[model samples]
Target: MMWPFDRCRINENDLFKHDWRSRSKVQVPQYIFLKWTLAFLVGLLTGLIATFINLVIENIAGYKFLAVFHFIENERYLIGLAYFTGANLILTAFAAVLCVCFAPTAAGPGIPEIKAYLNGIDIPNMFGATTLIVKIFGSIGAVAAGLDLGKEGPLVHIGSCIAALVGQGGPDNYRIKWRCLCYFNNDRDRRDIITCGASSGVCAAFRAPVGGVLFSLEEVATWWRSALLWRTFFSTAVVVVVLRAFIEICNSGKCGLFGTGGLIMFDVSDVIVTYHATDIIPVIIIGILGGFLRSLYNYFLHKVLRLYSLINQKGRMHKLLLSLTVSLFTSVCQYCLPFLAKCQPFDPSTTEACPANGWSGNFKQFNCAKGYYNDLATLLLTSNDDAVRNIFSSNTPKEFQPVSLLIFFALYCILGLFTFSIAVPSGLFLPIILIGSAYGRLLGVFMGSYTNIDHGLYAVLGAASLMAGSMRMTVSLCIIFLELTNNLLLLPITMLVLLITKTVGDSFNPSVYEIILHLKGLPFLDANPEPWMRNLTVGELAESRITSVTLCGVEKVSLIVDVLKNHSQWVPYCR
Candidate 1:
């Protein structure tokens, strides 16, 4: 204070003191712009990677199935069956080995782990590079082996890993020159990035951007802020755009991946269900059935997973042997079922009159003489998505008889449940959707026999109801189905089914993902605690305490108001 510069230093210190109101307002815009830009880049990368993985899985699975089909066409039944069995065994074993030996965290649907991580739980190597690679390849192998799994679940994990890497500046070993992305390296920003990436993954998987945003909000994230909403929406939009462009480019060169137009596309032109006042009875029935099925599925699925865990604890070899045994059993069933069912050749008259369409010609031989799949081998061996599409098609009843549909429903329910928690990377969505479609079509056929209703409509309703019940999701699933079929007219019915399904499901148990989290021992806090907790008294609970505060008189009220005016964190509780 004795020196002249000391007074100037004190003034400078006072001027630079921490003050929220006096901070530069321009930096806020810059920070938001940079953060959003980083999110956009993360979404772009996630979409491109997801598209690549889907294409790869489709091609590999298609080639393997076609190889077996070719052998069957040449009358080499035993060889084809052997090849199919061997292919499934080898692929599943390889995928399992990769997951077990390299990245154990990559196995199963990774949504639970991701959910736990987003809730501030630290999981070792859960989002590492090894997991990303193993998940991508292992999921591809599992799907190619004709296992009842979908790539959608693993894609979320993959997207999170990518975002984590991008946020961390492209891994520790490599250097990333992008300085803008460094802004998101902090913990808070990285969580937002991961959320955006997860949303992007769903967008790529379902080709539904809005549905993706809703899914992340409803199913995945544990903590959400209002500011993150638009960021996730923007990310989903970017992902969808990138994915669509990639699909367009790929379609221009090839005939088209998966037919029916784009990836994950469904036909919705033949829906004829006009909801009447009396139809609520049947809709409610469907919802109840869906809920019961979901509960049953969860119970049995948990038991199977327990058995697998016990077997896994014995030794790694035991797990591999189990994989081989399951593969062999599945192969025998696939081989024998087709011949056991009634055989019908394609009608010569129809074949002669048909135009030379490449797309139709490819799947023409797969159809029987009655314009439907009569052989068991064809029905079981065909792609899951294709089977679901056929179930929802207008000609479903003509193509699949009532008895055959029932048989399929029974067989797939068992296979899908058992195949879900295998050692390899697997998913529940596609299999569950297929099962739900079969259930719906069977009911729809029976109803159409008496009433003037479309079986396709029933199929749609059944699918939505079952999925909603199993996943315990409502709005997102409805939007996803609407986007999948590009049909706005089905929204009301979809909403109704989903609402009923979720209500019934909640009455029984939590969702599949929540169950998995509990089994894994993750510290996930439930938003809605169990009803039994209300019985406990505060005095009986340990570490419970009460804080006392003194009340201010009327004369001190002005001082409190003044404090609230100056302090942003303080508010007038009375108001």
Candidate 2:
């Protein structure tokens, strides 16, 4: 799933230059020290960025929800809906304008660009200072607007930006430099540092350090080495430490919603879960469904993105209008859907159920009686993370009705497809998990008669299957789900589901990220050659292009000048 790499990274003459080799040897010790130092900085910055995004999202989105609920409670339904839709429009417009005006590269999942970069393509302004700024603030606005997307993927790109900025001596504009960091000026060293940064970003996003390392190895980085693996591990470890420290500091409730979940974003540790042999049958069904749905997800998302490309190419105004339209649609759905739910009376026998005030409760009282809660409101009104927690709660089987879940799944699928490919910073990871959990919970209810599996277990495996199917990853995704749930017992099932889902997805279209890469016109060279290429030869390909004049290692300077003057394009050298 990669394009052919044809660029020359190094000059063979450099290996023979005595001064270059001597200077490299002299800088070896400093290189070792500075790289680790860079790793620590990348991790620390990544954690801080993640924490920053979370805080912004919580306060802004929380207050928006609070305001909407306040208006609704006052019996001003029209005003409440207007305010909700208006708030979403304002927030999303701000994010979209940032991308359209300052850094268009900051839009979308950004994992494709990161993948392309790590594969050796030098994407212009990809990790630039402007892109970083736009990404940070833009992501805050879009996510806070309640779009069906996450910030995890954007965080990776942010971390890489920080790494590139720091490694490149803190931006040329600032004119900052360090003697020890000079070694990273080369493409190889900088790429490695960026790889570590990518891993640290994952660690910060999910609070899964080892999973971060595996993510970098499996998805982000194409060139892996022993030292890089160690550096990546160290970087992610530092991220975990930094995130833990932030969580501890925020435990006093200073940081808003982030203070709620410590490290695991979706913690099911308190829940007791166990599955039988027969449970495997339903789990397999979940995997098969996940793959089928994922194929549809990728296919439709690609077409939508293509359509968006046509609209976006029109102008910046068109991009802003598009964003506003989507935000309005989302706000309308979020506000109006809860009315369709049937509110049920609260059950006091089940461990102090429902809430008197604020969000995060399993039960949401939206235009309900004094003692009743609306099931669909709980899934709709609450934040996506909280919605996930409620669904993943093993204690809440009857908490959500089948109709409510089906509604959520269907609505989220539509919203998620539209939400992506917009001119704002967005992520697909958490939204995928959220939708997958909804699908899983629905499946659990469906298979209720045939099996006795806990709905929560089904939700976890469902998330794994969809994630694996869409991302086309197995080992890393399995570990990510394992770490997210903190339930080691679910590993075998998670692995099984991931393997099946990826295999099935491979039989269909490429993973979502690869499709996105293609959309961006980044041709990634696949390791496995296509069957139709069996007769294609290097000689025919070379003859199609302009002839290259290869020079010897000890070629004269005049000869090099002559070749440079003669050739219209690149002149390939010996590998």
User: What global local distance difference test value does model 2 have?
Assistant: 0.82
TM-score of each: 0.83, 0.93
Off by over 4 Å in 1: 1-30, 175-182, 255-261, 264-275, 344-378, 528-575
For 329-391, candidate 2 gives per-residue lDDT tens digits of: 988998899899888888777774664435566777888877888888887777777777777
- What lDDT would each prediction earn against the true structure? 0.72, 0.82
**Of the candidates shown, which would achieve the greatest TM-score relative to the real structure?**
2
lDDT of 1 by residue, 1-575 (tens): 11011010122334345542464777557768877887888789888877776676666656777777677667787888888888888888888898878988898888898887777677778777888889988987887677766777887788788878777777566847675555454456777788888888788778888998899999988668899899899988898888778767776766233444446434455555566666667777778888888878877877787787788778778767776666667667755566656644443443222211122121223323434334344457756655566577653345566776677778878787777766777778877887888888777776664544467778888888888888899989999888877768778878888998889888888888887887777777566778988788655653544343333545487776666466543212332
